[model samples]
Target chain A: MKKTLYPVLSVITILAFGFLVMYMLYGSGETPIFIIMAIFAIILGAAILALVWPRFSGTSTVTPGQSPFLVSRGVYFLMVIVLLVSFLLEGFNSSSPWSFLYPSENPFVPILSIAIIVGLYLVLYLRKSVREKYSFVELWTMKANDEREQHIIDDAARKTYGFMRMLVVIMGLGFFAFQLLGMSFPAFSVGYILFLFIFVAHAYFMFLLRKITD
Target chain B: MEKTANRLRELRKVRGQTQEEMAKDLGVTRQTVISIEKGEYIPSTTLALKIARLLKKPVEDIFWLE
Candidate 1:
């Protein structure tokens, strides 16, 4: 039952993602009805993928804490980052670089964009293969942290946190200095920069933990 | 030395056990058992004790500080 459904969902997911990307890059006027249909397709595909994906995939034979599964998961995360940045920039309408792509002012665009992302998350989070390979449940549930894993996580956290703090302080001071010099950076830019810093820090720590724990 | 040296591989071999076998008995993944054998990762106290108990060996016999 699931085998037939999985391929169809996978195809829809790919097509919907492609359509969304194109929509972001070339959409104009109102949020086109076709694009909305694409988003709905993504939602449906994602939900079905979640339900059917776990069974056919091979169970992971890799050892816990040593596999590169987390890094692989990072790929989907990268896609999410791209989609979100494009959406946020479009919504902010502050002469963002990508503003020319979809310059309209529809609020539902961002909302539907977010819905697509939620759908992606559901698919990834629900996959049996992803769950087994990444110890997905255990890590989130706080059960994967045996002593060595805990030590690795703690070390990575300390380093990444310190680095992020220092970067934020320096950037904050620099922004203040720019203000003093009559060169103003907008609060939105500052917030965006800070968010990027935190996101990068998290990715760095995840990589570090995987390396050190292994 | 405590983290680098262990008799896990040798002991398991003598017991006619595969890494997968030991991992199953110890409630861990096979890669963990391999890592322990390779001296790449040291188990927690609870896991170490479980391994020792499963293999019918003293904790000192399976793992020790150099």
Candidate 2:
């Protein structure tokens, strides 16, 4: 089932991207339209990278005992650094006068947009990979059959997913309350705070859940 | 963390079968057979029936309330 779909999806994505690039380079546009199109292109490009990530990337051969925390944290940190640098350069720099930039308005909507695109792809990839790959060692007994092993593996994977979900909602609330009550400046201060909480909680929970997985 | 069954394990050994051989015959992983022998996992009804058939016994005879 999966082997057939992978190649098909990859081809579709490549065709979409090729069209986007050719249209952007050859098509005509002035300042306003150009900026709008550039923003759209950047977003679409990031989304493609995320969506095709699974096809290009192989599963981490890391063992169950191995922690993916450090790697994930490093990736998250690098992302934050890039966004922060871009924000600092664009915003609060009067000489450059890029009017589109504003911290109060979170000029980094494109970054969030990229993250969302990647996240959606990851969710889909994991849903497929976890079931097919895991050996389900704990579930098999000398007396057990294939059906028994499958049932156990399926149940354990689902339980891990459920715990992750709970942790997300819990940690998200934690960050939201911390930010909203701690600081306020903008119109949707409350909403932004909630979003920030959810994002941070996702990182934190990603770290914490590794401990609970085994 | 919980009590489990190994009646199947004892029976399989009495019938003279290795974990690897049993797993092959049952179409499951060796680790599953090990887990069962160690009383770490319980077989489902279908699996229980399969095991019983292999051992030439009834399901109830092979598994009991222990």
Candidate 3:
């Protein structure tokens, strides 16, 4: 029952993803709906793949302290820097750096550019070297392979949750303070706040995990 | 409360088992074995039993309240 269910789920996820991509590229209107659907599909696909691939590939264990990707720490840091710079540029110019490529004022262009960049990263991530070094499940979910890894993950998660909770409270107070001062919050600041929050959370989590493991 | 401690490293060494071998036998990562030996982490009862079984010792003989 489990074996058959996995394959069926995999097929359904793949077909849904394919259809979503086709619709996104060719379909018109309902951009928000498509965006939400895309996010949902990607998440569901990742979860299913994480659970199923490990059992099939026989790579049940991962080195405790190793990164899930073939990319070096330098590369990861470089990507983060690039993302930060792009966001800053977009905020200043009121348009993405990739706007010139599409040459349109459509709001979805930036979103499309982000999707393209993510897709490219996914392609590189699935290259032969990475596939050989790490299982698909490990790469996709960053799931712990053993008790030590689980401990590290839990430790990192606990710390990150605490940090994020504090951050959210501060952000809420700041927003309230601005409103009380009769000041309007800049729309772009919202994006910046979200970006920084996510970036810091991830960096903090990784730092904690590395420190614990080391 | 008394802190828990263990003679994991010593017992595993006496059994002529490397950390890697012990981890494999216990179905865990080597780091877990190392952490247990270092007293940085405590194993759950099930894992403690497994470790005792692997080392051919009683759980109480391997672990103690200190």
Candidate 4:
């Protein structure tokens, strides 16, 4: 099966769970309707996840985030995005006021929008702006008449790993600074604090544990 | 130092295989075979067995302690 199949499956699984959840949460009085809504929601979420997940974590040889239970660094990004979006759409007017988009409120919508947009930009940069000549899996898995490219691939993977580590560190530092002085920064404090904790935790895994090294 | 794997390159050539072809067979990449050739990174046991199987040789015949 194509690698893309997994995330598609993930989205389906998520939807099925969400429907069962709505069923349990609301009781059987309107269970069927709620179940339909939940299935729709799952499909929408899955579509988004399918498009985005592969760009970030697919094409990677290493299995990230450890079984995808909860999440690992590679998968953590998707989780972060989902959480932020959920936070934003918690209670907001949709494109049409009659239509609500994801249940976000006034405050969270813009914040989450900006956050998601930034995350999008960052992913693009990693995929494009940061140019590496080789992919890591190529090093270990490719066959070569000449050995040079294999070494290059290994080196590239290592550097990419290092670069990601550096990114986590930088994000951590930025978040730490925000956490310290976020009181004056409006929601910046809370956002920064969240960012800090996540970055610190992920950085520990990325570097100290060499979690992405594989 | 003398190489440890005796006939990886020869066996591959005898099969009229390109390094890229072998890499593709492994579902990994072309550059990986080069690494194996240069002995920069040793192949995993699975990969070693695969290469041996592909070449119609036992793993023992392909690899030996130097």
Candidate 5:
């Protein structure tokens, strides 16, 4: 089941990448609206397929002492680093006046990003041991995060939420203080700070729950 | 720490059950089962009851407040 679905999903994602490249190269703002919408729809559909397909067709090869949560978290960590580094390098090098992270017209960056993502998925599917490990991980991850886990998570989340709220208040006050002092701060700095906060907070809570629970 | 000590380890060993086996029977992770045995985590009434049922012991025999 998973063996077939993975390849098909990878193909669709690559196809979406092809469409996006062609759209960027050949299509203009005056290009037909339907074409742009179709391109977007293809990309969105492929994204959803990547996440949902395995849930339906996945088979498990769970072995004792192997943890699904650990494997999946490792995968997620790798994917995030790959994605963040790729996009951040692209953004930092961009000459766009609007924002550093503004979507670059350079097709290579987007294509590279797609290639890496597809490569990861394909690599997971092609290797027998890795594939079985991933399947077991997925199975365990699903079962491990049950209602009881959610209750534990919710309690932890409430504390994290309060911390986030306090952070927002401090940032808000700082912004006002800057305004009053006639000092300037880049809007992107605030966005970056918020992004960092969210990412760190989530990772912290996940670690805490995984440690104290299973 | 206010530990809720239990004889789960002894009972499980006597029953010839590994933590992994008990975890599967109780629909939880091996780590969770380990935590319960180590007194690092206290299971809810329902889970304690389920564990008792699986072990074929009274709840009091498996767990008690310390």
Candidate 6:
């Protein structure tokens, strides 16, 4: 069941990602043929790499309970680096450091970012340490392996819900204040808020899991 | 208030089972076994029963109010 489901889901996710990129690049305009070709080329290249990657055997070097912490920290670091790079590029291109926060007009920015993201995701998915414990689909879905893990997940989710509720209320009030002051909310803030939502949820889950497991 | 204490570590050692071995037999991670033995986390009733079965002991024999 998983063997077939995983591949199917992978293809679907990749295709969805490609379409998302296309929409981001040419929302109302016609997408150029080369852009479509480039996206497909990148996807095909990634698929080939996944198929040809050598399978790993032997004990995982990652400590039994430490994988979540390591993965979270790595993801957080990667996001920070990506954000900084985008900021720098935006500043260099437009003389506005905050331009990257808005949707980028340069097609290369989205394409490059998508390629890097897909490439890194494939690398992590194929990593021996991660692969030994979880399948690509399991990793993608964040499936729990045991009752204890499920418990930790549930607790983490509950805490995250509480935290996000508070955060949303505060953000709502801030936005309301902005509206009263006749200030326009930046579109980039919505994207940043979504990023923060994901980051905080993962961080919370990893922190709680590590604390319990340790 | 009474605190819950457990004899999990001692009983596991008496059975000559490593944490990893116990975890495998109990269908849980070694970290779960470690946490239980250290009294850092209490197990659910089902898990407690599973552990009791693995170690050939009763639940009360493994855990008690202290």
Interface-residue RMSD per candidate?
A: 3.4, 5.3, 1.9, 9.0, 3.5, 1.9
Give the candidate number with the greatest DockQ. 6
**Number of the top candidate by lDDT?**
3
Please report how far candidate 4 places residue A72 from its true position, in Å: 2.1
lDDT of 4 by residue, A152-171 (tens): 33344434434433444454
Candidate 3 or 2, higher DockQ: 3
lDDT of 2: 0.47
Q: Each prediction's Cα lDDT score?
A: 0.54, 0.47, 0.56, 0.46, 0.52, 0.54
Kindly report which residue pairs in candidate 1 clash with one another: none
lDDT for each residue of candidate 6 in B1-66, tens digit (9 for 90 to 100): 887899999988898989999899998889888888888778888889988898888899999999
Residue pairs that clash (backbone atoms under 3 angstroms), model 5 = A68-A137
Worst 10 residues of 1 chain A by lDDT: A67-76
Writing each residue's lDDT as its tens digit, candidate 1 over A1-214 gives 6566545544444444444344433333344644664565466446434432442232323333442233223323444455456546563674554444332456465346446655555554445543444564443333242445545554554465446545644664565587589873442344334334444655565556454334
- Per-residue lDDT of model 2, residues A1-214, tens digit only: 6555544544444344333332332333336655665665566546544533343344324332333222223323433343345344643564433322343455466457447745753453344333243333211111113544444433333343334334434444544465579753333322232234334533333333222222
lDDT of 6: 0.54
Better of 1 and 4 by lDDT: 1
Candidate 4 is graded, for docking, as incorrect
| Model 2 misplaced regions, further than 4 Å | A1-145, A182-214, B1-6
TM-scores for chain B, in order? Answer: 0.91, 0.81, 0.94, 0.83, 0.92, 0.94
Error of 6 at A60 (Å): 34
Q: List the candidates ranked by TM-score, beginning with the highest.
A: 3, 6, 1, 5, 2, 4
In candidate 2, residue A202 scores what lDDT? 38
Q: Who is ahead in DockQ, 1 or 6?
A: 6
Error of 1 at A41 (Å): 36
Over A55-152, each residue of candidate 6 has an lDDT whose tens digit, in order, gives 11112243223322222233334434544454446534644433434554565654465466555555544555455655644533454656666666
- Considering the two chains of model 5, state its CAPRI-style docking category: acceptable
Q: How much of the true contact map at the interface does candidate 6 reproduce, as a fraction?
A: 0.54
Give fnat, all candidates: 0.23, 0.38, 0.31, 0.00, 0.15, 0.54
For candidate 1, give the lDDT of residue A212.
34
Predicted chain A of candidate 4: TM-score: 0.27
